[model samples]
Target chain A: MDAAAHDTHDAHDEPHLTPYSVYVGIWLALIALTGVTVLASVVDMKHQAIFVALFVATAKSTLVVLYFMHIAFENRVFWWFLLSAIATFVIFVLLTFADYAYR
Target chain B: MSSDTAMPDLPETNYINAEKGLKSWLTTIDHKRIALMYLIAIGGFFVVAMGLGFMMRLELLNPGEQFLDGAAYNRVLTLHGVIMIFLFIIPSIPAVFGNFCLPIMLGANDVSFPRLNLASWYFYIAGAIVALFSVAAGGVDTGWTFYVPYSANTDANVMLPMFAAFLLGWSSILTGLNFIVTTHRLRAPGMGWRQMPLFVWGIYATSWIAVLATPVIGITLVLVLIERYMGIGIFNATMGGDPILFQHLFWIYSHPAVYVMVLPAMAVVSEIVPVFSQKRIFGYRFIAMSSIAIAAIGSLVWAHHMFTSGMADEGRIIFSFLTFFVSVPSAVKVFNWLATMYKGSIKVDPPMLFAFAFIFLFSIGGFTGLLQGALSVDIHLHDTAFIVAHFHYTMFGGTGVMFFGAMYYWWPKMFGRMYNRTMAYVGFAMFFVGFNTLYFPLFIAGLKGMPRRYADYLPEYHSYHALSTVGSWIMVTGILILFANLIWAIKRGKRAERNPWGGATLEWAVASPPATHQFDGPPEVGEPYDYKIPHLGDDESAGSGADEGKA
Candidate 1:
């Protein structure tokens, strides 16, 4: 509770810099995920194809949030904030499916 | 703490007079200025929405259509809900009071993203225009939820209002993001998380709900629009989509939205209850943590709304259980508030009166909600007048009542003028009585099986409807007096003291109506509710010689 406890924030005076190559790498992964999504749609996995496409889209978004949004370089509290959003989403999806699955 | 001299009669340059014209207000990034702008916008919409409610009550006076026909009544109902929920209640406490007070309470000059704060106001205005324009271009009749199948079929201008709801969600998300950053970044030097004010905690939890839950509804509305526009059939049963999915998505965002509406009001109670009682809060951490518990637990109970929509028993029971569980945190709050008042020096001032009213009324609302949460009871009261009555008890009785309370509590500090406390008490009395008279009857009628959303009721229900209509007249008269008294006090009331309420928080430390910059030095952080000894002392920075605990 002292001022010293807050004196050491992870977000210091200097910005956490990411190299250009890391951005290039994330861009390549995004392109590969897009191809996977399109390919999954054309293939006849039927019901699971939607899941496959969704899975790929989720990966793309994770990459964007962690890197493009710089959450990877941010403080621990930032992760807690992200986790809360994910928790809300997971609760909604799971509970919603509980109804649909039971039906 | 030095208390030799009293502070100045009034600050020569406060936020209000610091600048001089229309454009300064229009273009300003100051959180206080933005809050005032939101107050005007939200207040204007509230009156229009109230007028819509008045018309509905007028139409329902004797049943069988007083003036509005069945179709017209449907349109009027939809408009009222749309304006009240989207344009009014959703942003009422947070955007206005939260904006004006949070940064100062945290000992910062402004919100973290001041420009974004201004943008949220503009977004509110834009969405409001679209909603009002929808009314002119042949109003929507989907009844605020915009339930599908029928929503897709309705020829009413659903698209425009739906678009407006989407834009309002953006406004909410941006505001939430701004608040989260502010809370993380801007606490005064020594204040820790536990030492922060309960109002800040309330707003913090609400902001997360806004950020996380709103996007689902935004996309859900968009899908419906696309379904209607392009025959996408996502929610249209004939087109191989599930209408229940639409319900799932709608309430998923909406049920938490109920908390988005009420949590800040609860936070306001946590604040005023202690100051008026002349005691420190009973259990600060418990109250602070319960706000989050309510937010998280409240999010999971969305399916209770869908229980009678023909969902399976497993989902029904689970949602029912969650619904019952959510009330625990709220009950924790109510009990904590009661305990805070015990053996303390209690002042039945207007704000405390409103706080008392909030506890009594919201508890009734909460218990009734638990009644409906029981799967068996819900099967009977699913869409009855009881549901309508329960919602108002919580939203109107809880949030709307506290809105006036906040106006009374902070009026002097915000406007640099003290209102006539006697008139305020009179207004609160009429409002409380008229309020109970108006909505309390519908609970009985609902129990007696009068249906909701209908233009006519059975002859047996006539007495209930009549009494309720008369109650609306009483309530609106009380509301008129309440607003008139406050509005008149802006220029004419007594010049207020900087610390009239002896609050332990930071907002009272500066000049009444406060300077454009809040603190002249690092605000000394203490436990927010502590009132045993003086919480603050005379520093030129703290409006020289204005000491807390003087009252």
Candidate 2:
């Protein structure tokens, strides 16, 4: 197989080409999520507002990765790798925080 | 020009002869050529850094400074650390050998992005140049770590070196990106993950660490630069910034950066041991997985470096535990390597000797590392000569020795010439003896409470310091001889066979000093370490494949 065919095979067993409308929809969803984050910030959610804002931001980025980046259609290995990267980052942050908090 | 007409016989040109002139090399996108460029550049830096180390050892020969004063000694120490860490060890195995061999090992024509590979080399040179400029314009003495307020307030050319470090980090990240993509996409047909060479697996693990961890240091250095010029208080203690934060950020990358240096060395050992032992690698999957394990667990153990840096008790305890845990994967590798060598047809070639030495020296390094991992022990050993000795044992004995062994192993393949075996053996013996002599005493001195990075020491420490200095001279002599043998071999030695070591790998299938394009067609993937199925260079008896392959 050529490069394109090989890529399709590795990415999705059967290539699934999403419609242009789906991309547009994902873009709109990301925008909506951003707006939600902004709204959460403006409202007096107090300490929970930070969590809400983070949730919306995470949701927005997920939408971007899954749909816009075509990771949704990509192989499962990609998701595992992404998760590992995030986990490693979170571990670093948490460990650093552990030092700072106790100190 | 008829369709059936045989193509005209082109000149038989490998990458070295594929083009002519300095311009060809400068603009060349060929991974092999770029690897050669890096070998030369990185080799030069190694020599300079080695000289700096030699001078430091000379300075330490007596109780007081032999040549350099305190201030001068600090500058030399800083430059040596910076150059060795950034220019020599970090990029030595991966950028040089990885670029040269990864593509060929994968049976691909070149890396996924050839232009990007070339760009990374340029970035490396640019970084080196900036660093050298820093040296010329009054060197920075904040050390390679560039910790906190000293880095911020220093009158030395700190900004340039920091910028240089930033560029080097980018170079590292880009190389990682290119290798990761190449590994994922460019494997030969029928070569699955298991079929991939252990070296590729090693590079794969190292690349991920480089990609994820390097950016932290890049940003940290930028923060330092910002604080220096703009008076930003990111890590400045007086200005409410915590200095420990800098240690956290630096070691986050720099600790994993240890694997980035040594994993490829381990990968080289993984390749050499099986080939020379005349057996398939024992526990191939375990060895492969351990590389990944090292990368992952290695990243989490960065705080171990900050054990004595005033981190909280909880932090020290957690970090010490994690640090001890990281050693498990490394021990797994060491045991597996020993098993691979057990009762096998071990050829005591230069490469195998180095591999054996790596196991020994790296074990010493690892055990000492474990000693330092204990919170209480680390408080005693931290900032001492013992830590210095331990790091050298790990970095120099592990990666640096392996780097030379790789040069010996791949010299024939890379340059198509065989080096003098007598000289190689002599050099290896001297190097091994000199290495132990140089560092072992430092370990003892360190435990005796001799602090490191000092221009002078007390009368009681003089004997150990003298012995260490003598060992440094012997080690340098061995290094010189090794380089001389290889350099002479490149031009004057006997011609080399394609499969000099008689192992099974895709690179060995191709010509020694391979053709510009490594493979004419997709390579036939086989068990990478299948020694029972005799390789091309083996005799007919070995070729008969009567012996059952040992796993």
The interface RMSD values of the models, given in order, are 0.7, 0.9
* Model 2 Cα shift for residue B474 (angstroms): 0.5
Task: Compose the digit string of candidate 2's lDDT tens values, residues B37-81.
Answer: 999999999999999999999999999768899999999999999
Error of 2 at B494 (Å): 0.5
lDDT of each: 0.88, 0.88
DockQ of each: 0.75, 0.62
Candidate 1 is graded, for docking, as medium
Q: Residue by residue across B191-259, what tens digits does model 1's lDDT show?
A: 899989999999999999999999999999999989999989898889999999999999999999999
Residue-wise lDDT of candidate 2 within A1-103, one digit each (tens)? 9999899778756677999999889888888887887788678988998788778878988888888788888778888878878888899999998799898
Model 2 chain A worst lDDT window (10 residues): A7-16
lDDT of model 1, residue B249? 96
Error of 1 at B95 (Å): 0.8
